[model samples]
Target: MSEFETTGPERAGPERRPRVCVVGSGWRFTGGLSHYTCRLAGALADRSEVSALLMRRLLPRALYPGRARVGVKTAALDYDERVDVFDGVDWYWLPSLFGALRRLRRNRPDTVVFQWWTGTVAHTYLVLAAAARARGARVVVEFHEVQDTGEIRIPFVAAYTRRVLGALLRRSDAFLVHSEHDRQLLGDLFDLSGRPVTVVPHGPFDHYAVTHRPSPDGVFRLLFFGLIRPYKGLDVLIDAFHRLAPEEVSSFHLTVVGETWEGCTEPIEKIEASPYRDRITLVNRYVSDEEAKAHFAEADALVLPYRRSSASGPLHIAMSNGLPVVLSAVGGLVEAVGEYAGAVLVEPEDVPGLADGLRKARAAAGTRYPDPHTWQRNVEAILGRSAAAAEGGTR
Candidate 1:
């Protein structure tokens, strides 16, 4: 038997298991970062004493499945939990930054994991991580995407943000990145060498075991799933869909399945008023897990004409459900898409290229998706390395 299995139950002993805490906004809705945190926490919980500090904006039942699966402890803080929309993980809401810090100080976890994406939460996590380090706690920062010099438009703001990010990077003991593109950017932007930065690619759901029948198929279905934002390049997708020939339009239908974050709906509204109005469907609302599964199962292919993105959950979800994807070759997306037998990669913001990708994806539909075990193995290797590093072991 493997070392992990041989020790199995006995490995939970105090000397072996470390106290690990993950501090994040919350997990009441399905964001990529939130989902990533939950998955890691759940996986680690089986091997260590893992807890997550979440903002109180989640349903107790929705957030915490049960204490049986994982020893999940939740504390709710005074905040508009409604504003925090994440699901599938339990969160303890500490209302103010000070309250969060106080809780961390009280818990005194051995290792504190911080999830970072933007500047809004960077300083908050930096303070918490610093406090944890002051208490002799190890801090690890998991970056979904670090703003690149090319993607930053405002010079002064970008510089200031980079400075703040640098401070945070310097404070952490280790780093976790989703893609090689992100790892290179972290190293180049923050000088993050010699520090342990593990690359853990996200995993897809195993759809082969689940018997979910597709929706009645008269209309050709195309789905755009995830938070509707300008950076996601929905406008480019709409334009590309609009430019499709009438015959092609007749053979396909577009479904926009996600809520608008920055209230950017002008482009979508324009599409609604266009000549191909009847060919498109917009379910402009927060999609639940069931709804997401249904959409993926029913769709012919997932279209992600993202203008700028580091990684995508929708693409992973679609691929997991045995559906093919057509995404832009921007950021780490190319790495994630890899040379998968059942996926298509296109250039960023190229409407004709996107349309051609869509055409190709349709032509190559129903092929077997990439093996989920590949992603699982990647995740295992990263987590194992992170744990080993935390324990002062070599990679």
Candidate 2:
């Protein structure tokens, strides 16, 4: 079980490599999920046949936020498949959930890995799992968050969503959780003590290749990027930045660049209230890949002092950019950053500690990841035994 101790090849080839159906937003969105799905599918293709299943339309055009397309306008993926399922646009009563199920049954993939995130898709994914199970394909759900931040807003909705998700989880043959903390959280969320759960560390964001060609300049700078949400504890980060002595504050500039959502204005408010407001820049909107690259290139460190945490996608981005991180040692972050000399782990919401952590990172040299996670290693970890099982079937 210890990957560090393994001396031989990561995999023992199967007579027929187990075909995988990785279900997610193939190229449909531009964020952590789509990036993860696209890269993972590509990596799996290196060892086994891999296909990406995409939703034609997540929501009806009338209800869609920006554009009602199957893909992000700025991104593209090589693998994409359509599910001809009939869904009721008005309510969850439509049998369209079976569309993906039917597609999986027809394909009869060796394993179906469902991208498990958001309660909004719980009902559909629950039914999809049941359908996949009925058709005899091994089901694996990769959980991003054991729970979502928005869940607290609607307790009743969250309760029902959890019930539906629990059913799907019980029906799954295997599970892939990002870290041991997440594995434990999944158990707390639902009864997973009986399921085969593997701690597959999320790979670094290696897809930012052409866009990753610059290093931070002379001025000490800190960057925060991603969708802005309340649970991320940006206010605490801003307050901590304010707590730094005036001389230390003058030595650095903080860049807050990310898309903000409804009711997540506390960070913005904190920025405006700070005496060092002139030194802070906030781009409260969606950023392009080039823009993201530039931000990372110029940042001495990426700061993420979250209120609580799980496996952090932003942490992966920071590592891929080779920027040191000043992060709260909550959830899986402490383990994910794993002995990276550049990481400065601090107490969540501890104003003085966060300030000190940021100061330390200013003088710190970016460290290499002690255990660099790769999608190839992740795919192998999930499917190595399955591949051997596939070979046994041939025998």
Candidate 3:
């Protein structure tokens, strides 16, 4: 409880729920973290008094890759009704920050959880964390990735992030991550001598699984979905598709769906120049929820050949929909989907390995994988409760 607890009526009930405030990027940015914040707030509301403090503006539109579609509603997810929301603090707006502080002061949550994914919100998070700690609220920073791969590529932003993250982490009471790999990476990357770190698996992003509709053209459909980044290894998949046998290439169709980022257009160029150009479909833009649902529904399997990763929302989407997944074995991915019934793990950057995995996915096409993850388990871990207690055993 640390200094966050006060003997009051709110804590007097036999089944008193912890008051928690989850802070993260708002839907205006509309990506993985946005979905996660909404989903997490909903799950936490089941057993805790919850509030969502979101950052409406992540950065200037010119710098964001998907700036053209910023603020467009692309997801079909929202916060739980029981969870109060403050739709958020902006980069240059001092009033928004003050308003967020006021929300914290008024609600007085017992726990303040910050979803850490980028350096853009580091300064704002520091201010909120300091305010929360001063008022006796326990702070938790959940690590989605040690650092954003795109941001880390820049020398100056990376240095600033390193310093700001150190100070922010020093103020936190505990830490939460998606896997043991991430837990080890966090400790190795930061100074967490006395703080606790809990590994809570990422919950399913099943909201996109609206229906099942495999390709009616009789060709095997393979999907590569998400933001197009260099580290995601989309080029490797493109190369592997080209290397397939003529018969296999003729019978297979590859759908590359997602907006380009970090000036990554090599894969797109390769797809355009490939011999089997007609076999590949490139959306080359951010998609709406309906579009995503259609893509997932029509695909035979989902493929993620990330050179490195922490945890992936697309992987969970496939699992939720029972679609076969062909992904690279790297970072937290091995622990995340290795045991799944429909997962085929390939070595990162290996063209032949990926091609083989693709063939395997095609063979298992039309089969579905049962969803194995639950928000209940994720909620219990964040609140530091046992699975038995979450499932109705004595707390």
Q: Which candidate's TM-score is highest?
A: 3
- Two-way lDDT contest, 1 vs 3, winner: 3
Worst 10 residues of 3 by lDDT: 386-395
TM-score, prediction 2: 0.84
In model 2, how large is the Cα lDDT of residue 26? 34
2 versus 3: better lDDT goes to: 3
The sequence of per-residue lDDT tens digits that candidate 3 reaches over residues 138-238 is: 88898898899999999999999999999999998777787778888888889887667777678888787767875677789999999999999999999
* Reference-based lDDT, residue 364, model 3: 93
Indicate which candidate wins on lDDT.
3
lDDT (tens digit, per residue) of candidate 1 on 1-395: 21112121222333665566766655333355555565556555654566666543333343322212222322122223212122212223344555666666665566777777655455566677778877777677777778632336667757777888889888877776667777777787777658767666655543222333554665557889877777888888888887889988887888888776555787678667878989788887665556666677678788888877777878777766666788888988877777466678888999999988888877865555754423444334333533332211222
**Candidate order by TM-score, highest to lowest?**
3, 2, 1
Model 2, 97-201: lDDT tens per residue? 455555666666666778876666676666666766666666788888777777757789688778888888887876777767887788776777575677777
Q: Provide the lDDT at 363 for model 2.
A: 77
Q: State which candidate, 2 or 3, has the greater TM-score.
A: 3
Best-first order by lDDT:
3, 2, 1
